[model samples]
Target chain A: MSTTDNTESLVQLHNAGLREQGRWRVRGISLRVRAGEIVTLIGPNGSGKSTTAKLALGLLTPSEGRAERRPGLRVGYVPQALAIDAAMPMSVDRFMRLSNRLDENTLVEALESTGVANLRHEPVTALSGGQYQRVLIARAIAREPDLLVLDEPVQGVDLPGEAALYQLIADIRRERGCGVLMISHDLHVVMAATDQVVCLNGHVCCHGAPRAVAEDPAYQALYGKLSPALAVYTHHHDHEHLPDGSVRQIDNNASPGCGHDHG
Target chain B: MDDFFVRALLAAGGIALVAAPLGCFIVWRRMAYFGDTLAHSSLLGVALSLAADVPLIPAVFTVSLAVALTLVVLQRREWVSTDALLGLLSHASLAIGLVVFALLERPSAYLAEMLLGDILTVSQRDIVLIFSVALAVAVVLLLAWRPLIAMTVNHDLAEAEGQNPVLAHVLLVVMMAAVIAVAIQIVGVLLITAMLIIPAVTARRFAARPETMVLFAVGFAVLATQVGLWGSLQWDTPSGPSIVVASLAVFLVSLAVSRGRHA
Candidate 1:
């Protein structure tokens, strides 16, 4: 966790324990996200990444531990599925006002910041994946939240859209200085946007800078077989363009079994 | 030409105006079953009203609100699946209401009227009740429109922004309870869920935003009410079923039209 001088620690998960269906699922998970740092949790499927996000947001109380969010800190969250009924006519402008706090100028600034200003009056249901992601980001920002948590914001988007959204998130962090926590499997995107990385596999396997943990032994052991498809920021300097319009850089100098691309 | 048909038409119009917006959220939140749960709880209200000799609508509203709140609270605890909770509460309330109704010795007319609404028997007081409740629901919803939408889109996100998801949810359930109480007197419980779901679902085919969807649902409901009343008068059918069928017909036509547009 990167600590900034100005902002206090917003979230402290002390040895947090969470249970599912009366069974102990996550044990002894401790997390601290200091303000103004973008922390991304990367894990394989069923690794409790989503649960950690929910717990931090106070959506679910830990079964045997504590998730203490600082008093009155606003959180902006974007879930995996955009599951909006497209037929329901809601414009981005109207949706942002739902928090009932932000004034018009702030709302417009948020929309502009997320690059969703031009799409303000358009029906959110008709937005493309990229535009929809942008709208959700704008919705979160309109609240002027102290922490922004996104669960797979770039799940189904094309590479370009995913890249754009990562850039948008980076911009938001820079502009607002809000602490961001993203749960993602996209190593490249998270590495590009986040300052700290927490690798979870039901429990946190490692937590530190993206590059260090990317080469960590635990990650290599778990993702060694699926390295080609899963590795986000493979440090391979041998750059080769693939058929799917993505370049693969296989880093041979670092670890033997750790080579991937940033497509 | 008959007075019965004329009265039923007016009653349907009033419900169409109110049920449209409520139905939109019900559809969006997958609370089609929630309407059923709330409508069934009206039986408890009916039983209590008779047992205590209380004014019917207010008593029904209170009891239904209790049941609705219970469902909301239970859902928050996540003790059981939402569907199971809804099913349990729905049948329990309905069974208890029936048992209470059976135990009380009285003229069966009130019970009959509540079970199968006598739109033709609608008194001036009933019209007044519909008008007043409709006004209250419309105003409250208009005021709380944005927050409600945000809550529906993602309850956790809504709560993160200091908007009380539970309160917003209760506000919706209470509004629904009021709508069901008013409508049960017009459409009856078995047919009431149809009134709430079909119009909104049909409108969803055409509407691109929440406001437009509600407007379309209201228009469809009004049409259904008018045509159903007319058909019942002309063909000697039950007014409630006739209205449902009219709404269903509109829905089918809308589906066809939407398909054609896409084609």
Candidate 2:
């Protein structure tokens, strides 16, 4: 939590909650995003990550809390699933011009930045998933919004593609200084790329930097049981330690029979 | 041109012009069933109009608006899937309208006209009414085009852009209600939805962009209306169903052409 400066965040939610069908979908959630920051919400299935993002976007009003935006702040959003029909018949260029009109130069630049400029005239549904996602990102970035909200942006991308997309997003932030809030289920690659992590399961479980949350029992319970094969950010953890903070390599003073640390 | 043909042309042309733009969004949003439900509810509007001795257009618009609003509200509940909710509304409203038809004593043609349509028998007042509503729907759609497209692309994304999806939805459904109101005179409740969906679907085959799709849909609808009217004169068939059949033929041809290209 980077001592959230109220005036800097383009959008913020305060103790927000959404109640539907007499049940709380998510509750008591608070978030703040400032310029050039990337906030990623991560959790397992039905973890309220999307719900929280929606609340912050004011797509779902809170039954208990409030979501606020700086007046006249422009934001661009990439939703979890667009769900547009295949029959809608939209070209990538047309989709980019939906909310805001862009000059040819800007349009080409945005599409080029995302590496999809060649696809501007193609039907949107004809594009592959990776291309489709890149188009969506380019559309959002083209508008020069103050904040960009992306929900589960890398759902259908391969591992390398996901990394490349994250890199592209980081470039956008560096170039435009737009705040970003995105949702994802991936634990490793996302943790390394994002500045803040909000782990949620019905409610916020833990939120902070990736390194701090690695050893968190709540986060570990949710993700640690899985093998390290999925971990993209490797750190040196060859040495084990007890909960009491003692190095567990065979203490030669006490474990002579053990082959451990037998200098 | 004969006055009768001229009036039919004006009414049908007006409806086609308006339907093209709205239908594009409907197809984009995959709201065919939703459109059907709204069309079915127009019967309730007509029934209410006759039962209450209220004016036809306002009553129809009101009831359709009511149904659209109800759908929007129910969607928020999430207890019922959108498809299921539309199913319930479609059949229920149809049944209720049929009941109204049975109980009320209007001209024998009234029921048939409401169920199918009677563009050939439209009066000057009806023509004026049709054009007025069509113009309104077109204007509203033009004004809301940006927000509507954004919402159709992704609801949360629109909200994150500081747009209210509910507001966009309300505007869209209201425009739909207007089209339904105007179209009920030319195509009746049963075929009203066809007018809203068919042209757009047919245009999908060749249109590479959304706006081009809208333009193509309008052109197709105009051509379908002319062919259907001419066919009706040649074969002494119902003008409205003939129009629908013409559009269906176009859709079939589009399918074949697109399939051949893909193959």
Which pairs clash (backbone N, Cα, C closer than 3 Å) in model 1? A88-B209, A89-B208, A89-B209, A89-B210, A188-A232, A236-A250, A236-A251
Instruction: Give, for candidate 2 chain A, the lowest lDDT window spanning 10 residues.
Output: A252-261
Please provide, for model 1 over B113-194, each residue's C-alpha lDDT reduced to its tens digit, 9 standing for 90 to 100. Answer: 6776666777777888888888999998988887788788777767766777777888898899998988887777677888
> Candidate 2: deviation at residue A86, Å?
0.9
Residue-level lDDT tens digits of model 2 in B77-142: 788899999999888988998788778877877888777777577778878888888877777777
| Whole-model lDDT, model 2 | 0.78
For candidate 2, the per-residue lDDT at A204 reads: 75
- How many clashing residue pairs are found in candidate 1? 7
lDDT of 1 at A257: 23
TM-score of the first chain in candidate 1 relative to the native first chain: 0.81
TM-score of chain B of each: 0.92, 0.92
